[model samples]
Structure formats: C-alpha cells, structure tokens
Target chain A: MTLEITGLKVSLGGRDILRGVDLHLEKGRVHGLAGESGSGKTMTGLAVLGLLPHGARATGRIDLGGRDLLTLPPRELNKVRGGQVAMVFQDPATSLHPMLSVGRQLTEHMRHHLGLGRAEARARAVELLGKVRIPGAEEAYGRFPHQFSGGMRQRIAIAIALACSPRVLIADEPTTALDVTVQAGVLRLLRGLCDELGLAVLLVTHDLGVMSAIADEVSVMKDGLVVETGPRGQVLREPAHAYTRSLLDALPGEPGGPAEPGGKA
Target chain B: MSNTASGKTPLPGRGPEQARARRRGAHPLARFLVRRLLTAVLLAWGITLVTFVLTNLVPGDPVAANLGQRALGDPAIVAQWRAEHGLDKPLWEQYALHLQGLLQGDFGTSQQSHRPVAQDLAEFVPATLELAGAAILVSLVLGVGFGVLAALRRDRLSDHLLRVLSLVGISVPTFWLALVAFYVFFYRLQITPGSGRVDPALGGAPPVTGLQTIDALLAGRWDIFASAAGHLITPTLVLALYTIGLLTRFTRSAVLEVLGQDYVRAARAKGLPGRVILFRYVLRSALVPIITVAGLAFGSLLSGTVLVEAIFAWPGIGQYAYKSATTLDLPAVMGVGLVVGVVYLVINLIVDVLYGVIDPRVRLQ
Candidate 1:
C-alpha cells in the first residue's frame, strides 16, 4: 500500500468528529471517499495532511510510506506537505493567492521542494503550465489568479499540485464548489494527470457522479466511519452498503450516458 | 466601506424590491463612515462638555482671570465682555454658542493675543502637519516591517517578545514616554539640535511656506531641512514608538489569522512555498484589518501631537492648544478643539474610502 490510514480518531470542541477510521490505497490509483455533509470525509483528508482547524485533537496511526504522518514533527510534516503529498481544495476560486502573479505562485514550490534557483524555477513553472494545456503559458505566468475563469483556475490549481510530482494527492471536495459541467472537466483532467504523473489520489467528496468519472476504488463513509469498500464499477453497479446505494440513487447522472466525448460509458 | 462594482450578484434569490432596499440601506463604506463619525462626534461632545465644564467648575471666573487685578471693580466691562462673547447666559447657552461657532467655521479669537483663533491655527497648522506626516511615515515603515517579521516567525520568541513590547507601549503614559525620550536623546546624546526645527543660521526660513521642510526645499536649502530633520528625529521617534507597537501587534495577529484560513492552506498544498503563501495569499487578505487599525492609529497620532510637541518644544497644534488651555482662553480652546475633531473625522473618512479601494467584497456590501 502506498498510503494506509488505520484506526484514526479525531475529536474537536470535545466532540468526536472521526472514529476508528481505516483505509488502504495502492500507488497510481484513485480512491473515492463518498460521504454526506459532516460525515468526516473532509476531516479524514485534513488529518492525513495535519491541517486541522483550531482546537481539534487527533490520534491513531496514519502512515504514508511508513513516515507515521500523525506523529511526525512540524518541520518533517512541512517537508512531506508539498513534497511527497499535496492537496487540491474544494474552492479553487479562493484557493490561490490573489495578489501574486501566476508565475510567482507556481515557481515557489519548485524553489522550496527542489531548491531550484529563480531562473530554473521560472522556466519550470512555464513548462508545468504548458503541461496543464494553459494556452500561452508564458503570458499566463504574468496573469494573476483572478484573471482566469473558474475551470481554468482549477486547471492551474491542478498544475500547482503536479509541480513537485508528489506520490499522493488528496483532493477535498475538489469539484463540489464548481459547476456540474466544469466538475467533469476537472475530474477528467485529474484522471489524465494521475496516469501521466504516476501518482495516487484520494478523492473526498459527496458527489457520486464525480466519483464514477475518476475513482478506481470507492469507499462509502457514514458517521465518521467507512461502511463499505469495493471497486468503483462494482460499487456503482451493486452497492453493498445502504448509504452507498442511497448516494447513487440521490445522484441523477446526465440522462443518456457519461459526458465524455467519443467514449460513452 | 465598499460599494458594488461588478453587476453580477453572488446571492441567487432576492426580489427586486428587497434588492433595492438592500442597496439603499447604506453602502458598507457609507455605513462604516456614518457609524465612525457619529461615534467620533459623540466622543468629542462628551469630552468637550466635560473639559469645558470642569475648567469652569474650578472655583475661578475666567473673565476675572483675564482682567487680572482690574477684574473686581470693572463690573460693567466684565458684563459687556461676557455679553459680547455670549458667556453672560446659562452654561447650556454657552455650549450652544460654542457649537454654533464651530458649525460656522468661526472659532473666535485668543483673548491673550486678541487674534482670531482660526487665523492663528492656519498660520501654524501647516508646520505641525508636516511634522506629523514625517512621524507617520517613520511609524508605518518600522511597524509594518516588524509586523511581517513577527508573523513569519509566529509562536517563536521574537513573536512573544514583540507582543510584550506592544503591551508595554499600550500601558505606558504618553507624557511620561515623551519625557524619557527627551532626557535620553537631548540631555545625554546631544546629537539633535534639541528643540523646534531649524537653526538661527537658516534665518527664520525662506517664508515660501510655513513648513520648515517645504521652505527649505523650495529655496534649494536642503541643508536647512536636513538640520531641521535632525532636530525632528528624536521627537518623531518618540511620537511613533507607541504606534509602531500597536501596528505590529495588529498586523501580526491579522496575518496569522489569514495564514490559518483555508485558502492559504490550499495555496501551500499547491506546492507554493511559504513566502508565496504568506505574501500573496495571507498578507493580501490580512491588509484589510491591518489598514483599518493603522488608519485609526494614524488619527490618534494626529490627535496626540500635543504632548510630543510640548515636550520637544516643537511649534505645533498641541503646543498651541496647551498654551490656550492653561490661560483659560475659551475661544482659543474651543476653536482648536473643533479643528482637531474635524481632522480626526477626515482621517477616518479617508480610511473608510480605502476599504472600498482594496476589497471588492467590502465595496459590494
């Protein structure tokens, strides 16, 4: 397993938020964590990255390549944050720094993680933007985050996550804040990038439709614990858990078939 | 306060009438200003009423003090003078007179100099403003720099030490700080020219403007302003010290709050380094609150100019107010007080407008 989380416990404001959560993931695979609102889906991702809100308490074993992420010191955790693992957030709109040029934001990681000098970092940033298929990557470098459209910004957010070529990428409701049409595009982009970059993805969202697009393995969570786990195709065809069945029933996918061009599933 | 620029609405559902009502309720900038001005006036009125009453309530007639030994026998003259200044009426009537004079821009005259108080203020206002401007510049540079440092190293000893320093600054008496600054800079170091800007060698300025710095600059006598700046250094340092502490504390806390926000964490997770997360993501949002506090602090510094000016023997409004207050020059005091109050109002108004310029959300609200 590339990433394994076992018996995770999280409490905040004297109330248990996550309880005895266990999960395992293979390399270069996408695992969809499906849950309702306040079902600890987001908190589970945060615990992995050590990004909890104020006054939250966490315990139990979370190992990313045997690093013991939960017990790692802040400095080591910081090293892991943008190096081995990175996260894309729900609201891509607000996830970026507003004032800085795209170039400045994109190059910063290269400098910190790779220890690249300014010239090399800038060159690499433009290359990364090009990989994300951002038109006029050189010009886009000068543009601020606000200049991009919602979908384009998500692409840039994805580009940033790929900068360090991290092994594991945790996306917390990555498409929840986007429009339905844009959500599919982002999911497709994430799926393509995972194959190209050779990385593992932890998809945390309540949207079943989004899960079906990119998720290889699916895990259904209810009340802070995983209730079911199976292959994405099998889970969608025949959900074992009641919550999983309900989640699929709740989502009314596009009337005819999937939205992919030339290949309808 | 902010007003909407983009026509697109964030909220999907609202009837036309309700939206219109929301729009008319008061732009955030306008509301912030209205609240601040109302608060300023209420505080100003209370302070004025207390100061006026307390100064009078102290067992002595200001008119009698004005007349010196001649006050006892010249009852007719005293009554005439009282009626002319509209002081012969009840205490409330006197307040009404003061208010009326204030609204009309007629602050009356200094009884001592027999000079119109408004005219006298105009003569020295420019000079004091120049000095205050210099002090504010110094405070902003030092304060923002220290604040950025403290925030970058949050939870470290430097952050803790800076917080303690700001606490000390807030607690220390302004006048006492001024005294200590003077004794150390003037009495011991003797590096400065000591009091009031310019040497006699500069020959009372070029008279192009009341401000020594400007007059010196206009005449291409950079040397004179340079010397004046030297003299100004110590007092300006003293003037800015407390404000620096205040701004640093506010900025550090504000930046930390922004850093902890989800958006900043997202940026960091994007493989963007700490510098990017801090300067671009965190500090930009943090600036709104920091700028607000900085504006209020700037206004307070303008108001507090009196003590530092007096301590340094600088020719400024505070010194002028003090001279007028000590001599029971009611007209002079009321005039200076009104001007000071208006200055504070204007400063805060500008600050409010700045919010609209910085954040579109604030403008929309």
Candidate 2:
C-alpha cells in the first residue's frame, strides 16, 4: 500500500470533526471516498498530509510507505511534501497564485522536489504543461492564472501536482467549482494521467458517478466513519450497510454498471 | 459604445479618458486628485484669510505695540505709527498691500524685534523643520516596528502587548511626557544637554545654512550633531509617541484585512511557507492604506509639535508663532500662519500624487 490511514480522530475548537476512520490504498489506483457535506471526508484527507490548521488535534497512524506522516516533524514533512505527496484543490481560481506566472509555480515545485536546475525545470514545466494538453504551453507560462479560463487554470493546477511525480495525489473535490462539461473533462484527464503515470489518487468527493467511473474502490463515509468499503462492483451491486444502500438508492447518478476488473470487491 | 464622446453626450464636459474611466468604473484617481488639490489650496487660503481677520480683529493696538514702551500712553505717537505702518487704510487695501508684499518678498519688519519677516523666518523655520523631521523619523521607526511585529504575532500575546503599548503612548499627554523626559534625562541623569541644538562652548562652523544641525553635519563635526540629537531626542520622542500609536494600529489593521482575503488562504493551502505567504500575499495588499496613514501623519507631525518644542525651549517656528501672538506681532504671526498653511497644502498635494502612483485612481483638478 502506498498510503494507509488507520483509526484517525480529529477535533477542532472542542468539537469532534472527524471520528475514528480507517482506509487503505495502493499504487497506480484511485480510491474514492464519498460523503455529504460535513461527513468528515475532507478532514480525513487533511490528516493524511497533516494540513489541519492551528489548534486542531489529530491522532492516528498515517503510514505512507512505512513512515507515519502524523508523527514526522514539520521539517521532515517539508522534504516529503510536494515530493512524495501533492494536492489539487477544488477552486482552481483560488488555488492559483494570481500574481505569479504559472511557469514559476511549476518550476519552483520541480526544482524543490526533483532537484532540477533552472533550464531543466523550465523544460520539465513545459513538458508538464503539454501533458496537461494546454496548447501554446511555452507562451502560457508567461501568463498569470487569471488570464486563463477556469478549465485551463485547473489544468495548470493538475500539471503542478504532477510535476514532482508524487506517490500520492490528494485531490479535494478538484472539479466541484467547475461547470459540468469542464468537470467531465478534468475527471477524464486526471484518470488518464493517473493510469499513465502509475500514480495513486485519493479522490475526495461526494459524487458517486465520478467514484464509479475512475476509482477502483469506494469508501462511503458518514460522520467521519467509513460505513462501507469494498470493490466498486460488489459495493454497487449488493447491499451491505443500510446507509450505503440508502445512499446508493438516493444517488442522483444513473445506477452504475459492473465495476471494471480490479475494482471494488 | 460611443467613440470620442460628442457634444450630444449627457455628460458633455467629460473628456474621452473620463468617459472610458466611467465605463470601466475604474479609479478616477486623476479626477480625484484634481478635486483634492483644489480643495487643499482653498483650505490653505481659508486658513490664511481667517488668521488675517482674527489678528486684525484683536482690540490691542499693534501699532502701539510697535512703538516703544515710553510711547504707549501717547495718542500722537500711536497715530503717527499707525499712519506709517498703513493701519489707516481700508481692510481691502491692507490685505491687498500685505498680499502684494508677500508676493514680492517684502514681508515687512517684525514690530517687536525690528527684524525683517524674512530674516526671522530664515532663522526660525529651520529649527521647526529639524524638530519635526526628528520627531517624524522617530515615529516611523517605532510605528513600523510595532506594526510589523503586531502583524506577525497577530491574535497572539505579542499583538495584544503592542496594541496596549500604542494605546498608552497615544493617551499620555505630550507636555507631561516632555516634562518627565526632561526631568529624567536632563535634570536628574544629566545624560543629555538641557536645551538648544548644541553647547555654546564648542560651537561649530558659522551657520552658512541657518540650520545648526545641517551646518554641523556639513563641517564633519559629528560630535556636535550627536550631542544636538541627544537633546532633541527627548522632545521628539514625546511628540512622536502618539503618531506611532496611530500608525501602528492602522498598519496592523491593514495587514489583518489583507491577510483575511481568500488569496492569502489560498497561498497557505499551496504549502508555500508562512514567510512567502506573508510577504507576497499579505504585505503587498496592505501597502495602500499604510501609505495613506504614513503620508497624512507626516503632515500632521510637521505642525503638531508646538507644545513639545515650547516646553523643551527649542527655538522653532511654533515658539516664534506663540511669542508673536503674545506680543501681537502681526507680520510675524501672519507670516507663520501663511507658511504653515502652505506647508500643509504642499504635503497634501504630494500625498495625492503618491496616491495616484500607488493606485492610479487620483487626478489633478
């Protein structure tokens, strides 16, 4: 397993935001954690990378390749962050630095993580931009995020996430703020890139359509606990927990067909 | 949609740039500047006119004051003096003559001191400038330090400490602070000189520039200047403490506001270190308001140190103006009034120009 989270608990300002939760994932796979708002899905994701804000307390073993992430000090975490793990946020418009050229944002990550020099990083940034299918990638490097369309901004963000070839990519509702057409395009692009790069994606979202389409496994969480977990095929086809059953029934998505090979089971 | 706004346009007076600015709803900083400068000039003139009227309305006979004490009881001497000084003329005639004299560099002699108004200013204005300059520099150092520290330690203990410190600074009376500072540093400790820019025992090169500190610095006499600063420091500190408090609070609030913006939160989420997030995202956005407070405070500092200079026995324009009022030296009082008014207006103009550069929304009226 590339990343394994076990029995995570989180509290903020005297309130329990995340109750005990456990989840596991391996390399070259996408696991979709589905939940409604305030279901503790995002909190669990933040715990894996230790991104919870000031005064928030978390306890659990988040072992990414045998090293407990929560236990590592901040200095050690810096060496792993954007190197072993990277993240893509929901609102690309907010996620991007408006004042900086996208090229600098990419090259900075490349130089920091991959130890690439100035020329090497620039070449890699252009290649990453091309891989994300941003046309005129070289010229686009000079432009700011605001100059680009919302879809393009998300693409640039995806490119930044991929620059380090991280072991784990935690995408927190990467397409939530985007339009439907753009959402589909971004989803497809992420899935294709994950397969091509052999990267593991922890897709944090509530949409089952997205989960079933790209994720090999699905973990349905409620109130910060993973209520049901299985291969996508078995989970979608058979009823196990009542909450999962109701969630699947009430789901707005067209009932998903059989999960692909190596899917949830 | 209209190109080159024509006479038929509703706002016919607006030029093409103004029309475009209105369409975009961008900062009409150029227009704003034009309006502000006009207001500043009118404000200066209003202050000058009021000072002129107030001084003339005083019942004491300035012409009698001009005459020596021996001539005070003699009506013939007062009448002769009034006739000679042009007090017999109409108010308009007096104002026009004074304005003409002001325009032509003929400021008339000080009645009490019998010095040319220009000569009195040349000797006195430099002293005020020095005091104000030192006070402003001290405030800038203290205010910016507290502001940056407060922002860094925002919502923390240090932030609270600095805020309380600034409030205390603002609340204390300047005259009391000046007196206490004098007692501690001069009367008790004897660490610094009591008054004036320098000691008479070691006077430096003659005043080629009229400013003792400048002349001393020019002569490579650091010792004299240093001693002068030691004396000036106490009073400057007294006057600047309040300004520092105001600026620190303003800067802290400005930084806090910018730090709350979504872009700042976004920068943090990107995993960029806190230092980068602060300097790049937070500081840049806080600059506009910080610049504003600093500029206005600078003008206030220039004229606001009157009581401090007076208590410290510093020879400056404030002391000169006060003495002129008591002695009823009309020319001297009017001279200080006109100069201070001009200084305030010029400083405001500079601020407006700076505002335009900072945001490009201000324009000259």
Q: Write the per-residue lDDT of candidate 2 for residues A144-203, one digit (tens) a residue.
A: 675566777888899988888888888898877776555667777888888898888999
By TM-score, who's the top model here?
Answer: 2
lDDT of 2 by residue, B179-199 (tens): 898888899999868887677
Candidate that would win on DockQ = 1
Scored against the true structure, residue B226 in model 2 reaches a CA lDDT of: 78
Q: Which ten residues in a row have the lowest lDDT in candidate 2 chain B?
A: B1-10
Off by over 4 Å in 1: A252-265, B1-249, B270-280, B317-365
TM-score of chain B of 1: 0.78
Question: What TM-score quantifies how close candidate 2 is to the native fold?
Answer: 0.73
